[model samples]
Target: MNQELLKLDQVSKTFRNDKGHAIQAVKEVSFRVMRGHSIGIVGESGCGKSTLARLITGLTPLDAGEILLEGNRICGLSGKAQRQVYRQIQMVFQDPYSAISPRMPVGTFLTEGLVHFGMISRKEAGKEAERLLQMVDLEPQLSQRLPHQLSGGQLQRVVIARAISIHPKLVILDEATSALDVSVQEQILELLVRLQKEYALTYLFIGHDLAVVRSITEEILVMKNGAIVEKLPAKTLVRDAREDYTKQLLSAVFSVREFQEP
Candidate 1:
């Protein structure tokens, strides 16, 4: 019995450049994320994947259509209403360093959301932060250190911990592992899989790498020029993708992998 957790109905966004040329960053995209399922959106840069994520998270205004979370309208809500809706959604960006405050201690960063949302007392936040760090397989003591003191992988783990701290219903990962080393990326992916199972989480993973996206998601959405050109099961994408654009992406990824092999 699968449940629908998030829905985007003909969602669209447009941006104007310096010359006032309209750019349809996201154009009438529609999708549904089932509860406790992982869906990946993959495309090259400037293909509107990130913009779509922003629209879902309510960070950007939509030019058309609606976004719903748990059957409730999430877009265009005001102040407290918006914050309440957003608390159900969390995002992990490509750069962990840019996602977190450099000046804030790691523990504070992890627990701030909890405290702000009244999930825990200030005194209890320390222990909760440690627990969150442990959940991500990071050292509890690392929570006391600044973001700069941790490695890229460690910082990303911290960011992930923070995102899950409030127990969001949908987690949007926008190229979350692209900035890490290959070995580190594997570790992070493993962590994500574990967390999703443990928390009964739903993921909306966005990235440019086909292989990586296939490895993590149940279904893959192929985006090109602000529209989804293909949607297919992850296991069959390499063999069954229908769109020419999707086939080209697979070819490109295969070629890159071949070139990198020993």
Candidate 2:
């Protein structure tokens, strides 16, 4: 078996409330992500799934525990080290429009990371920008377009392309498809599955949509109140969840099936 690509050991994050109370966003959470595998973290709205992504991507400082990437401790790196971590792991945020810069064209948006990492020349970045667009199932000609011109689904495709432009080892999708319509959501999931196979990408996909999560994840981690209550294979979690919370989540997801006459 392959070694783990990412590890979160007893990770915890706390926020101070306005009332001067400490809100533990993630409490002693631990998990491992092997290379080329997709791990879905799913729970209800306030279950801290997104907060966990923020912690993994270094957007928020952890109150406790360690996060290891490729078996290297990266939770406290700074300067050049931090930049290196930033390069190897990228994030596609929940809102594509908000995640992408409004000021830059699609080509510029994709190439900027290449330029920042010195992975390619400015001219090369410009050329590869078009390819990146195509890779995401978007027309290369769309490179000239601005964010406002693209539909919500199109914006998300751009976001996915930009995230993979650097060819990062890990990509965190924080509810990336939640903003799209049903057809577009299917397209995005197909795109993600294709890319994962092609690039051997390891993803930590965080979301509330169990169906959406099930579509992509090989394993599922079910969370509640900042702690993981159950960890099971994706199909097992769907059909045979053991926890009350997991059953509740599965109930909500399979509720769609309840409406159909069989």
Candidate 3:
């Protein structure tokens, strides 16, 4: 087993409605992700799975506790230090269409981070973007096109390429395959698995589908109502689930064909 890559200790978050009533989005969540292993966070919508991803990636502020990367505190670092820490993690959102700007050329989009990180010059961005596109199984010429020109699956691949262009150690995939056709979903998931092995990248895969989560992750965390209900190895998820929510989720997965196209 690899050493701990990330640790979240008693993390919590609260949200306020229009009337200013408090709603706990995440409640005392705690976990550790070992290096080079993919961990799945499965739950129904509004369960704070997405919020947890946001917290890990520093997109949103944590209301409590600490988020550590490689045992270093990551919650409050600022400026270059903050950016440097964040550069180690990348995010792939569910909707590629909305995730990227429709107006920017793919080449510019892919190399923006590389340029910002001083890893490459603007003059070399095009070539590097082409290389990244090919790495993600996309055609180099596609980099010249806009986001709207590509299919959902193609765009998702582009998003993956962008996320990895910076060579991140961790990738947070928030429902990354849920919006595509089932076949496309499988292809994307397989691409993720291959990328993971090739780069030794750690993944924080968030989704509502039990079967989908089980397909790629070795360990699973079940969440409901903003709290983690159980944690189990993926192989034993169906057989060893103890919580009613976990059983209900597993039953739902088994009730379906589990492979039908969406």
Candidate 4:
């Protein structure tokens, strides 16, 4: 059975120039995020990694192809229907430092998002905000602080909290943990895994860091020049990658001995 929570089929996007030129950004990309599974998309910047995330989450309209949400192709949905898609889909951006609202206190932004999505009432949102903070391993008191007042890792957690506040069906993480320290990255990754278990979140994790991606992903898609060059089970790819690009990505994460060592 197709138990996928998200699916992109023959999806492609392109930008145009004033002279009627088209610049292809994504080329015939296809993948799936199954219920409660994490799928990773890895590629360098400008490789359409972020674009694909936006397309899946309905942040932007696709130039071609279809995006399915729970077996329904909502890519063509407009107006009220599209808004409904937003409530089910959310994104955690690459730079938490800049992706979130610096002026608004963490609690304010988080609760506001929850209330806007009707996930929680104002009073309940406040309490839930604190609960979510704790889920991410942040102190409740930190909720009152501005983004600038918190560490990078803490800020990323706040971003995650805000993204998941609405209890989204699919969470698109665009290099979400790339900027944090190594140790803190582990914490955030663990928090995501825990949240996925509790919430049944279907994650589409985008990053160039294969090591970080492997830590959380069930499947991995290697992209190059705006297309998926290869797709494989994360564990199998780590052990035996078929594509050269996949090999190059894994080589950076695991040395020959590291993969073989006890």
Candidate 5:
């Protein structure tokens, strides 16, 4: 068996109202992600899927529990340690249009982080940026254009390229393909599969669509009302979900497909 690359032990998060009413966003979520495998988290909006992503990425402080990377606690790290953590864990958000700056050229967007971390010099970044763009199947010239100049699918590939440029051990893709057209979504998914095989990447893919999640992930986690209600192999999710919520979601997805078929 592969050694666990990441672990969440009873991880929890809460947000309190001004009146002191605590609303739990994530409740004691626990899981392990092994190297070179993908775990999918699926839920409707407001089910704490995005909050879990935020907690994993250190965008927010954890109110409770532990997050570990390679058996080391990642919570409460100093700035220097956090920067090191970032090199191991990266995220690609849902919207390419807003995820990157409109004013920054694609080359700058891809290379700035590498240069900031002293991994590569500014002079060497251009060639490295072009290399990454090629890895994502984009022409090197596209790096000269701004974010707004590319179509949504093209910008998303750039985002994926930047996320992988640092060679992260784990990549959290929170609805990374949700913004593109259906055909574009398939292309991006294929690209992700290729990249993962080439890089041995462990993915934490968060999305609402069961079909999309099932297509790329090995394990599927079903969340409802801020808690995981079911966990199953991706191949069995539609046929063997023990939770009504999971069944309902699967039904809805299939219903739409049937309704749209010619």
Candidate 6:
């Protein structure tokens, strides 16, 4: 039987805007992520996908809800406890340039987490960093270069290498490939698939693109207006989706594809 890796029970979050207006970013969202499974959360911008990612990663606190990682509550942890939880749950954000520091060498960025967690000594990090780069299909020598010296795809690969270097149980990718061109995006997606199989890593992929999400995940969650409007298998999304919002999203993707075709 597949084990449960993560669970969110009635998770909700509300943010106060500049004018003090309360915005319900996430509303009673509940879901389960099975070990070694890939689940995708798909919606348009402002549909609360990113907020949901933050909630899972503990970057943002929840107003009312429980986030359980391996059956332990992770919503309200602090200090050392929180840091420990973070080691098991890593995140890759939308913009690779912004996710990494401009001044840091790629190798240091890849090995910093491993060193901080005492997984490896400072002297051992260099070889391990090179190994990680190779795992991500990046040239080991590129690790000596700064972030600006690498292309967007290469930098994103580095970010991914860093996330997995510590052997995290779950990875939350929030628009991870949206910043790259189509070709680069495809390559990254393939790399993620291979990595997942190699490491038995569970993934929570958040993105606005339906096709991309479907290609990578086993199940799909459709969100609209801060709530999950539908949940269905990725293989049958178009055929199984019943929500009007989901159909609308499908229509939009189809229209865009048609427009782009010769």
Give the residue spans of candidate 4 off by over 4 A: 18-20, 252-262
**Each model's TM-score?**
0.96, 0.96, 0.95, 0.91, 0.96, 0.97
Local distance difference test scores for all models: 0.93, 0.88, 0.92, 0.84, 0.91, 0.94
Over 171-260, each residue of candidate 5 has an lDDT whose tens digit, in order, gives: 999999998899999999999999999988999999988899999999999998789999999997777887888888887864555678
Residue pairs clashing, model 5: none
Worst 10 residues of 2 by lDDT: 249-258
User: How would you encode candidate 2's per-residue C-alpha lDDT over 15-121 as one tens digit per residue?
Assistant: 99899998888999999999999999998888899899888878788988999998898887778988898899999877888977787898898888889999899
Give the per-residue Cα lDDT of candidate 2 at 31.
91
Winner on TM-score (2 vs 4): 2
lDDT computed for candidate 6:
0.94
Every model: Cα RMSD to truth: 1.7, 1.3, 2.5, 2.4, 1.6, 1.7
lDDT by residue for model 4 (1-262), tens:
2387888899999988899998788999987778888899998878889888877877778989998889999896888998888888888987887876679888887777778767677879768878878878789888788989988888888889888878888898988888888798888899999989888888889999987797799888989888999888887776767888888777666456666878
Task: Name model 6 segments beyond 4 Å from true.
Answer: 254-262
Q: Looking at candidate 5, what is the lDDT of residue 10?
A: 93
Error of 4 at 237 (Å): 1.3
CA shift at 208, candidate 3, in angstroms? 0.5
User: Which ten-residue region of model 1 has the weakest summed lDDT?
Assistant: 250-259
Highest-lDDT candidate? 6
For model 5, the local distance difference test gives 0.91
Error of 5 at 132 (Å): 1.0
| Candidate 1: C-alpha lDDT | 0.93
